[model samples]
Target chain A: MAERTNSKKHYRDNFTGWLLNIPYLAYTAVFFLIPLVWAVWLSTMDWNLMSPDRTFVGIRNFTGMFANPKIIAAFFNSFRYLAPIVVLCFLFGLLLALLISNLPDRIKGVTAVLFFIPYLTSGVATSVVIRFFFSYNSAFNHFLRERFDKDISWFQNPTSAFWIIIAIIVWKMSGYYALFLLSAIESIEPEVNEAAAIDGCVGFRRLVYITLPMILPTITTVIVLASGLAFGIYTEPYLLTGGGPNNATTTWLLEIYNTSFTNFRSGEGAAMAIANAVQIFVTIQLFTFVMNKLNRKFGV
Target chain B: MKRSSKIKTGILIAITAVLLVFSLFPLFYMVIQSLMPWDQVDKSMVLSHPTMKSYQYLLGSGNSSDAFMWVRSLLNSLIVSVPTAVVSVLVGLCVGYSVTKLHFRGKKIIYESLLFQMFFPGVILLVPRYILIKPLANHYLGMILPLCISTWAIFMYINYFTTLPNELFEAAKIDGLGEFGIILKIAMPMTKSVTTIVFLSMFMARWNELMWDMLVAPDIKMQTLNVLISTQFRTMGNFPGPMYAASVLLTLPIIIMFLCASKHFKEGISFMLK
Candidate 1:
């Protein structure tokens, strides 16, 4: 009788817990899980919004994407953006974090807020402002022409367009990443610093040997975070270049948007999106693996 | 040695000053350029002749062509983001509260699923989500539904609730406080900081969101400021003032929020470090 009563109490507790979770659970089912399954099913059928009939295409959409040039460009451009973003963001964030950490406490708070402003600015807003700056009759272009006898259409050229996107992303993200590194830097024990100082470790030597090793895990996290962010690069490229100048900056998200929505090839778009998802999963795993190896090797 | 330390501090300050110029110059330029007349914009570094024509235009006092639906979209932004932030927090708080405090069979699975969703690429569901939301297009339901739950918000609450001592809840139970009553009175009161952080971030995320907003709401009457800015920017090249003004307007609320609650904003960012 005692055991049965205890089991009943446990069941009641479980029921209450589930009842409390009903909102999130029901929401995930309708919005997330249902769409997820539908996405997989849609990948096997050729369909569009206007059409009432759907034709089953089997795996043709998946296979065709591998051979498509736009798909191929999208695949490669992700890596093209990923490497520089990780490197530049890491370097710039480290510099800012180190500089800000050295400041007095009052100024430090003010400066961190000031630096974080760009991250808060919407990509659309920033891109609009940047577009105006680089317009043909703008002061920037006029200065380029008069000073250096160069009047370049910034967005028309593929290489300049690519570099412009990278510059914007780096500008936007570096400070946010700095906040992460700043917290990590601040948390380092003063005892550790004092001991290193007593042993004559200071300045650049201390940074390289002592500080760098201590902050490796955060560094790893930041790099992985930045790398994952590269896959989601849509706003700038979509607004500025339209994946143009010989498809130089065509990102996976851009291609997916165009193929699915613009062209109404939902089946093919689903296939590409699935592939993008798999690639993201694999790349993150690879990055985590590499970072883990580095962490272990660095004696962290 | 004291002199060297002072010199180091001076050097650091100088470097920071230089970097600040680079970081802040674009925003400064935007504000300045927005103040210029259409003809004078992007022509000079200094705003010799400032006007409110751009801001006026964005507010629908300019030529009809230039006054295409900016303020309405701003309202739409508010309508969508506020509800999204509120609903996301409530759901996250409840789920977070239950997961941490209650005994459940599938709590571990739910947590694991949330973690997977956090790492999941959101782009993969675009096609299917569009199809599902197609019937509800031009409706606020289509715009706000998908974004009403975030894995990050749930995690934030979960992590915060975990830190509170279990004995407090036990004590409340001993005092005949029901589970819901304890959550409402005790748990909610203690989690004000975490709630603020989650709510602010969620609001910001939904406000800044463009693609999903654009996709779901193809109706011009229902578009957010971001979508309006993006679509108008393509053709508004010659008249640059309104574009700058619109961008400024889009960013203003966020800037204000950050300035007001910078400590909480920084705390939110630090949560990611954990």
Candidate 2:
């Protein structure tokens, strides 16, 4: 009787478990699994889905991506954006986190929430505001011209346009990243800081030798996340620069978007996208490996 | 040493103050500019003549473009995002509870697949997802269906569920509660914080989304506020005030959510990062 009841309960558990998971299982199968399979197949075909005639031109699209200048530019742009973003966001985020962590408890939450507001703001809205701020005849430009006797085109020059997009994204995201680092910093035991202070490790010495190493794992997370964000940047550049000033700011997403939709080269677009996915996977894995190595080397 | 430490503290406070200004000035300028009369926008920093005409224009009280349907798009955004977040969180809760609490076959496989799904960027799936959902274009189902199952939410719930004590569930079970009963009566109540976190974050994500929303719904009637702002901002150069007003509308819902539950919001974000 006991064994029979146990078997019955097992059966019931299995039944309910699978039943509860059916929705997500079905969703994943349809949206993620099927599309993934279809993307692989489509990457090899030289025809769009809407077209009646389908032709498979095996591996041609993959090899062809390397020769495309836009693809090359995109590949380089990811790193170009990634390096500065990682460094700047790390510095700014660490600073914000450290500063906020030390604030009086009464206003700490307020300041932290205020900093996070930009993260919640839509990319499109912020882009619009920035564009208007820098547009010709705007008060900002008028101020610059009147005071400095200089006129700077915000989005026309490639280097400036690149930095502008970078600056905007950093400003929006650093606050969000700071929250992660702040939580990590707050988790440190009070005893550790007391010991460090007794050892003359106050101020910069304490931050570097004590707090930094302890939160190195979270810093790794922030770096990897910042790098990932670099690849996915589309809306800001699309709105503000249109990936222009010689395609300097064209990201993997923007390029894939223009390719698949505007140019109707779905096959090549799929190839580029697959390349992008591989790039993200490899890059993140590489960062993880390097960060782990550094974590150990730092003796944390 | 004491004087130097005071100077250092002062410097840190000064830096924090400057950072706060940098963080907030854009939003402040946008809101102030939005209040300016249409002709005064971008002409000066000062709101010498503050007016409600921009808000009125968006709300159909004045001459506004037929293409910029603020009311209709706002409704569409709420309709799509609210249900998406709710359904996604509820389903994630169920799946998470099942995977963690219930004895099952092949649960590992399902969990592994979710982990795998995270590594593949959504860009790769764009073309095929577009092809698949093109039939459902301009429909709310197209917008919501693909986003209704979030792996991240499921993972979060799973992590939270594991931390829940099994003894409590066993006691509930002994009291004649079945699986769904225990889940509804105990698990759901117990995980309220996680549920709130998941729902709020998912809602914010869907609300802020642009790329997929723009792709699936090109029609004017079905556009979200985000899509409307992105597409209309470039063309509305003559009436920048209305654009700023729309931007404010875009940000208002999220700011309210943050104000209401910032502690939970911050905790949720930090938990997800971990």
Deviation in Å, model 1, residue B259 alpha carbon = 1.3
Error of 1 at A72 (Å): 0.7
lDDT of 1 by residue, B92-141 (tens): 88888888877668889888888988888888888888888889999999
Clashing pairs in 2: none
| C-alpha TM-score for every candidate | 0.96, 0.95
What does the interface RMSD come to for each candidate?
Answer: 1.5, 1.7
**Please, what are the lDDT tens digits per residue for candidate 2 over residues B77-177?**
99999998999888989989988888778888888988888666888899999999999999999999998778889989999889888789879889999
lDDT of 2 by residue, A1-300 (tens): 454668756545778889999999999989998999999999998875568888889999999988899899999999999999999999999999999988766777788888888888889889879999999889999999999998999899899899999999899999989988998898899999999989999889999899999999999989998999988999999999888888899999999998898888899889899999999889999999999998998736
